[model samples]
Target: MDRVRLLVLLTVFVDILGLGVVIPVLPFYVERFSNSPQAVTTLIAVYAAASFLSAPLIGVLSDKYGRRPALIGSILSTSLGWFIFASGKSLLVLYVGRIIDGLAAGNLPVAQAAITDTVKDEKERGQVLGYVGAIFGIGFIIGPAIGGALGHLSVTLPFWFVGALAAVNAVLAYFFLPETRKQQEAHTHPISLNPFSPMKRAIQQKDMCSNYLAWGMFGLAVASTQSVYALFLNVAFGWEEFMVGLLFMATGIVLAVNQVFAMRNFWLKKFTEPKLELWMTAAFAFGYVLIGVASFPLFIVGAILTTFGQSVLRVVMNSQMIAKSNPTRRGEVMGISASIVSLTAAIAPLFAGWLFDLRPSLPFFAAAVFLGIGFFILYSAQKTLPTTLDPRQPVVSEI
Candidate 1:
């Protein structure tokens, strides 16, 4: 494993450590300030909007400047965002904090670019990626429990605590994180903020568009679930903040277990490439449908199943995206994928929030429908994928 990859993975996990801790608490905290359910939802929406709008630009920056500095800047910005969020005495400040987080949302993608940049062999890519997933699961497990305990102090404490942790993470990265971008030797254009350029480059290539479709569908499903789960738990079971922590912690444990012990080889063997995506589509569709109809017991059941399904989908989708992309254009392809997914994530909360208001079941039901659509797209498009689990240089095109 590249030492740089390990650093970036640690950086990602550390950053997520703060996020998982705060996420379970965010909606409830918002509700306390403004009873407007829509307003609370919009709080999420604003962050997503910032992420969606900026991801492409950020990716290009990584392309031009390099992944390490871009990631470093994003981490520093994230630390600042948490500080603003923790100090906020009003909803406006909350909005400001989220905006800051959203603007720096390219951290994860840039991290991915670093991984891609450092690792040339596909098999090692999967292994390194699996390690990253395991680290993320580690964050998920500890973050919420810590947040729940600190939350007893005050709702705002976790945000500040996370801010402190993120600052620690930034320092760690500055000292240790390595640069992976190799553009210094290549023929490449300087990154620009010109709005139409990235999109034009991304779509101009045929294979790039195909892979991006798979990438987009995965994001839509994943985002819908992440956005609405808090409201669903609050409304359906009247879960307290601590209880929400337990559920997230539970998911994190499961995810961690699979990524470490079971998922990598299991998915690699059982659901290879495009074929695996179909299974993922079905699994995701089934899980969300169950969530829509579940009572208290069933909600738990649905959560467990959906987590399993999503883990598989995420691994397969990401692996294929890397494999399918041509080496010359990998960063561009990855950037397009991230931007589309971020856009989906940004819009999803607004839709899920409104749906949550209409009916507690509305978000879940919509999740199923949207995933069903994504699944169908994957199912139909399966032929485009390489047949085996082995990685190859990707070639995507409109068919």
Candidate 2:
């Protein structure tokens, strides 16, 4: 592996591993503050909302300044946020910590931008990003198990662990990850502070709006499913913690597999961005229906396919987000685009939780219906948007 890639990937791993440590314990921590399960969901919503608000700002800042400082600051912000979360005794402190973390949420997007800075070819971007994502996914797999095991000792332990890890990430990023943005080249453009400027372009241009809305709707389609899917599994099978962990690890497995091989071997080469998108539309429609009605074995199968299908689709969507944007405006464009998706993510879980309470199957079925509609929106956009491919390699047949 490339040394710089290793640095960036290791930094990401350390950062996410801390988050993993909290996965099994976060709900329990929130419960200590309130009797309502909605409280846990609300906490997550608060974080997502904060991220949605901060991403554009971070994007704008990165565009003016450079990636290194932005990344270093981002890590410090997360470190402090987690510290507050670990130390806090009340809901107010938790919310404050989440807001800080939201600001730092720019890390992933900005890092991707950084990767784009270093990665010259398009084909390599997918596989490289997949490796980046795989590291984070492995963190998710390893984090919870470690966190859950640690939580047996103290809920606060994992938070401190995450906070410390984030601090370590800051140091690693400082020493290791290079500033790849052509800063001297970037300095030629007039800097922007008006956060709405990026959105204004989308407003003025119909194609930009089309791409933005397609991504937004796709985000919304999956939102309710995440919040309710665990509940669905629980109601359907009375799954215990280990079983749920097993299910989560299953998603991670597919994610890892796709990152390592499928993305490069089949997905990226076979499907153009538009074609892969269309397949995603079809696969999700079928997958959700399967999730809604299938028995345990079938449910597992659907969930895996959903992961594979979405992973395939998202690889393209993210690359397109970068490729389509004016390079100067990339940070702002991606941040805001992510915000649209994050907005849905913020709302999806709450709705899913509520729907799950009413009927376990209801959320999956509802999401399936919405996904079908979302697919139509994507298809409409696909027809008009020319196939945008990576710059690195020859295009392959549609799988």
Candidate 3:
């Protein structure tokens, strides 16, 4: 791997590592102030809401200014957010911390843009993106276990550790991570502060609307289940924090193995990105159904299946999006994608929390419905969606 890709991947790994550390323990941490599931989900929604508002602007900024600065700024913001969240004594403080982090949550998009800037080949780009997903899995594999151990000692310790890690990450990035955006391409477009403007423009583009909508629905499905996962495990199976963390670690293992091995060796070799995308949505739908069953073994199976499916599908879909979008506007398109996911995340948690209060399994069922709808959208629009496999064909160029 090249230096740019390595640095970008390292940055992404650390960012996700912090998130993985928090995922299993966040509910327990929030319970110190408020024990309600709604409170926990509400905190998640607040962050996603903030992210939805800022993602596009961050994208545009990276496009105009440079990815390195945007990446460094985002890392610093995340470190600050974690510090505040770790030190918070009240629920309001927690919300404020999350909002700060969310507002500058442009790390992944910028990192992706950096990779795209460096690597020009579409097929190789897909493989590199799989590596990104693999890193996420690897981070989760280690981070959750560490978080669980630290949380067992003190709930706040894990957060503090992640905050420190982010600080160090930022320093490393500042010294080592090189700017990847081309100078000629930089400063070509005027910056737009309105987050919704980019999103509206994305939807207005031909062959992108259905893709964006499908991605949004997929995000909603994942977010709904994820926001309530720890609570669901606790409620459904009387599992504690350690076990919940371990379960996530197991899922991460599944994700890592699938992305690294199954993707390069089996899936991509056998099927095209579009075909895998449609099929994976169906797999996700089925997995959610199995997860909704109030059985531990069934839930484990479902989790593994869904994790594998999602890890592959995410990479494939993103590869398709990058291929279809204009090369100069990759950052903007990636930001729009992030914003759509953020929007769904903002909405899904509230609905999931409500459904969880009604019935533990309802949220998973709702997730299945969302994936089913996404599957339908993709299936119906499959013919219209352009593929990058044919180098002779023109991709979507209109901004």
| Model 3 lDDT tens row, 141-175 | 99999999999999999999999999999999999
Q: Report the alpha-carbon TM-score of model 2 versus the true structure.
A: 0.90
**Candidate 1 — which residues are off by over 4 angstroms?**
183-187, 388-392, 396-399
**Model 1 Cα shift for residue 83 (angstroms):** 1.1
* Global lDDT scores for all candidate models: 0.74, 0.72, 0.87
TM-score for each predicted model, relative to the true structure: 0.92, 0.90, 0.97
Q: Which ten residues in a row have the lowest lDDT in candidate 1?
A: 390-399
Model 3 error, position 220 (Å) = 0.5
The candidate with the higher lDDT, 1 or 2, is 1
Runs in model 3 deviating more than 4 A are 389-394
Candidate 3: the clashing residue pairs are none
Q: Clash pairs of candidate 1?
A: 206-396, 206-397, 207-396, 207-397, 324-394
Candidate 1 lDDT over 1-399, as tens digits, reads: 556776888898998899889988887778778876677667877887787767767777777677777787888888899899889889899899989987877777777767767665655666666666777778889999998888878988999999898889888888888778775523166666774576777777665455567667667666766776777777778888899899889889988887776765776555555776677677777788888885767767787778877776666677777776554445555566677887777777777777777787877777777777777777666666445433334555411
Highest TM-score, which number?
3
lDDT value, residue 173 of candidate 1: 81
Global local distance difference test of model 3? 0.87
